[model samples]
Target: MSPPHAVIAGAGIGGLCSALCLARAGWRVSLYEKAKILEESGAGLQLSPNACAVLRKLGVLERLTPFALAPQAIRIRRARDGATLALMPLNDAEARWGAPYLVVHRADLQRALLDAVAHEGRISLQTDAAVTGFAYGSDGVAVAISRGASRLEATGDCLIGADGLRSFVRQKLSPDDLNFSGRTAWRAVVEADRVPAAMRSEETTLWLGRKAHLVHYPLRQGTIINVVAIVDEDFQPDTDNFWSSHGASKFLEARFSRWDKSARDLLSAAPEWRKWPLADRAPAARLVSGRVALLGDAAHPMLPFLAQGAAQAIEDAGVLAEVLARGQDVEASFRAYQEIRLPRVTRVQKESRRQAVIYHLGGPAAFLRDAAMRALGGETMLARYDWLYRVRESPGQK
Candidate 1:
């Protein structure tokens, strides 16, 4: 008998990861991307322990380590005075969580995934191929794809929507309005030489402030520092606006004018910036319908506060691959995939939204938050992620 086949839409972190995971599980995969060329436009992303374990299992982690930085810790500070509130040590994360916490440029990780996908004989990736819609009955699922002026259709046992926030595949499956949280994230990468040694250390530093927060971490093996400042303001997006849209420095300068000198200095050092409106969606009633299922951002678009957007997406890919490779009926496998993923991703989405508010608290609230952090200390705080960091590396694992 021929092996089961899967058709995937989108080629971002989630899509590419899905293809690699499925192929490793002994399934032939047809991955499609709407973009003629694949390029990750964002800055740095955190690869938590859970995500790292999955990547390691898929044989993609080693390719990423050269470009990935294992930060020693995450230092949380008060934006007004730059006072240390807590220090979460990550130096021993691999020992505690079973995998290392890594920070790397988004493009580097994407390239690694693409490289792995290219080498897989069971996987075929096609760019300039957009999945417009899909239909599923008893004869598996057929995807309608658009390629420039031509159209084509492909059949597979299942369809995985790994497209990003504004996914066409998602619109056809579980449609929900994207909530713009009256927040914007301005991101930039400053050369290591341009940043002061204190600001460019081997730790991820976070500054909490009034209606805003700043996070910076070293990337590219310490040659550059990725900085992101998220502020409270709703920048209504238009048709032309992308996730990483061109941003003006003046806006960031004015909003962060009253922050501590260290925060201002880091912002000034960035030669240019790109901003993205923070958007998320409520968990859908069902992530799977028939032979189709959603993965990554398409399934659960969460805020970046918890730094689990990519991690959760990676987790989704792992679980989806595991369930589908079980040799069950195609529709049952997709339903099983949803059953395993929806709850965990929903929790991360809610927690991420809560953290956003806590990071931008004002006057009295900010003080109490800091005091609590200091009292809690670093190790105590780190203990909270135990549930998140310890995950199943394979279908048979505990």
Candidate 2:
């Protein structure tokens, strides 16, 4: 008898990671993408230890380490004068969390996953093919696929909606729009030499101010610096072509006009900026509705304040593969996947939202928050995240 097959929609970070894990577990997989040309895009993202462990298991970490940097710590500063608020030491991250905390360009990480996916004979990735629909039977599913003008059908024991925030598959399962968070994230990459030496350090620097905050870190072996600035503001993000949206440098500088010279210098160093409005879907009641299941942003879209957006997506891929590879019923496995994932992802979502409020605090609140940071220091603050970094396997896997 042929081995069970799985069909996946959206050949993104989550989808690609899921394909790798499933293929490793003895499943034949068909991965589909809506774009004709599959090129990775996006700015920088921090992969906390939770993500690195799974990447190590998938064998993508080795390919990634060369292009990424393991920042020694996260330096939180006051935006008004660039004074340090707290230093969350991460130089010993690997020894403590069982994996390294890597800061990588989104494209580089995607490339690493794509490279691994290419070597797997059991995985078939087809660009320009979109999953238009799917039907779940008692044992498996039949998927409707579209590639430009042509249409075809593919059958598999399971279908995964790793599509993304505005997933077509998610629309079929649970219909809801992703609500904007009344904020905008502006991202840019500057040459390391263009900014002050501090911005080029092998540590992620976060400067927090009233109603705004900025994060900057070095990428690609410290040749370039990735800058991300978030402001409590508003914009109607273009749904169809959002990531490509560009912002004026003057507008960005004006927003940070009151910020410290150090902060403004880093912002000015960025020659151009691409922006996206932050948004999220509320935690779903369930991540699985049938053989069709949600993964990554489709399942739970959360604010980036926690830096777990990508990490959580990577976690979803890891858990989904483990559950399905058991060879049990597909829906049962998906339910098991949901049961394991829902609570954790929901907590991270709530914490991220709360952190956003804390980061943008003003006046007495801001001062107290800073004072608390100083009181706790780096090690204590780092200890608080142990729950998030530690990944416990399912009871059966153990």
Candidate 3:
């Protein structure tokens, strides 16, 4: 008998990782990417120990290490005075969580996953292929693929929708609204020569303020720093355009005018800036429906506050692959994967939302929040997330 086959939609971190996991589990995998050319966007991502372990298990960690930055700590401070509040130690993260924390450019990680997928014989990848919809038949699940003006069909024992936030596959499964929080985020990367020596430390730094927060961390071995500034504001999205070249400097200049010179200088040094509204969906009790199921952003689009958006998706891929390897009915496998995953992702989503609130506390609330953070100290703060980082998974079963 032939090995079971799986069809994956989208080729982002989650999709590519899912394809690799399924193929490694003795399943023939077909991955469909909507983009004609898979270019790495200029953005950086944080890989906590939990996500790094999964990547290591999939055999992509070594390829990623060359581009990864292992920060020693995360420094939390006040945006106005730049006074250090607490330092979350990350140097010993590997010893504690069983894998090291890493930061890398989004493109580098994608390249590594794409390279691994290319070498795997069981996985066939198709670019310019968008999964429009899917249907379940007696033999298997049939998926509609749209390529330019033509539409084609592909069949597999099961279909996995790893497509990102604006997934067409998700809309087909159920109408889950992407709620835009009254907040907007600005992101930019500044080269090492442009940043001051003090700001380019081998640690992640966060500046908290009134109704806004700033986070910057080293990338490319400190040659560049990825900066993100998020502020609470009302926005009406064009619905057509998810991102635009807005005047990030102007917006940040006025909002963070009162912040310390260090923060202002970093903002000014960025050559260019881009803006996007933060959005998330309400947690759904059921992430699986029949032979078609969801994974990654399509399944749970959480806020970036927790830095677990990608990590949760990577975890989803690992669990989904393991569950499917059980040799159960296709529908049962998907249901099992969802049952094991939904609770954890939902909790992370809630925590991410809560962090957004805490990071942007105003006036008296902000003061008390800082006081609590200082009193709790960095080690305790990191300990609070032990449940998240200590998760261990094996391919045998859930």
Candidate 4:
């Protein structure tokens, strides 16, 4: 008879995309975000063809193109000599996957998704509402949230946790299972005009050295460059829990002092920088618990080496929405969602860890690794990722 109502926690990319997909499937959706104002906070995010396809299906791809860049190639170079170790071409990537690879500001993508959600009549967004507790029973699920001094409650057939790494919903499920990856990532955006003309390029460049790596790409129609430098360190700063904590330029420069000129130049060009301590959790044996389901980073948090953090989250939203639209038993649909997604996300998590080791090889080991990568060539890398980039969930099925 009536469409089921869904309550989504967090308005990040995953949550917003989930809301969009559920609303399109004729489900009434309400999204709660703790932030009073929705603004862009992070640096750049690279969307593979899989993520791009989902956005295209959601009708926001065209709107995002102006603020995004589709690089023709990705080059991995040695930090000492800038010698290319491997090159993956993206010239015909769109022809193969039906969508091109894209890089965009985290804020711009969020804005585009939010705008699309605004047009959906079945979806209502409530900002400044922080979900405090939830209860699942035979009748339904009831969520308690707070905004300032006021408390609000909502009941729905299902509750999805699309919140980020520090998800409140996750705390309820597996409170003591969180694990840290022992790596810290520093990110910043520098204006193209401020960078030296010789340093700017249309390609995505990565410089790998011992225990650290730097990735740089163009964003905002090539007007700004996004740089992410990750280092393996034993300690993290004791400060606020925010991901966008300001970082010191001197500390970063010292970390990369032995790197090549290209990385040095890029690091010097950074106008603003923030630090993010990469963290993850062992795969939850189950993503759904009765009337509640976990989505995005809350369900599966992976390292950024593979650049699939957001991409996987977007995939989760699509698959979950498709299963829920079947009108089958909610528990059965959610169980199917976890079964279909767990294996893939687990593989990604493991691969990302392997890449971290590969990118940080040192001395003779680094040279040997580079030689092996060159022998395999660019086509091999692209071929290796086809399974990840080509996946699509069939609607109305697990």
Best by lDDT: 1
Could you estimate the TM-score for every candidate? Answer: 0.97, 0.97, 0.97, 0.96
Evaluated against the true structure, the overall lDDT of model 2 is: 0.88
CA deviation > 4 Å runs, candidate 1 = 239-242, 393-398
For model 3, what is the C-alpha lDDT against the true structure? 0.88
Write candidate 3's Cα lDDT for 52-161 as tens digits: 99999988999999999999999998988999999999999989988999999999999899899989999999999998878987679998999999999998998888
lDDT at residue 367 of model 1 (Cα atoms): 86
Better of 2 and 4 by TM-score: 2
**Over 4 Å off, model 4:** 237-242, 393-398
**Tens-digit per-residue lDDT, 1-398, candidate 4:** 87899999999889999999999888999899999997766778999998888888899888899888898888888888788888989878788776889888898899899889988999999999988999998768999989889999999999999988888998898784555577888988899888777557877888889999999888877898888999887765443553557778998889888877767888998887888778867767778898899988888888899999899898888888888888887888888888888888888888998898988889899889988889999889778888778746473332
Candidate 2 lDDT, 13-65, residue by residue in tens? 89999999999989999999988987755578899988999999999999999
CA lDDT of each prediction against the hidden true structure: 0.89, 0.88, 0.88, 0.85
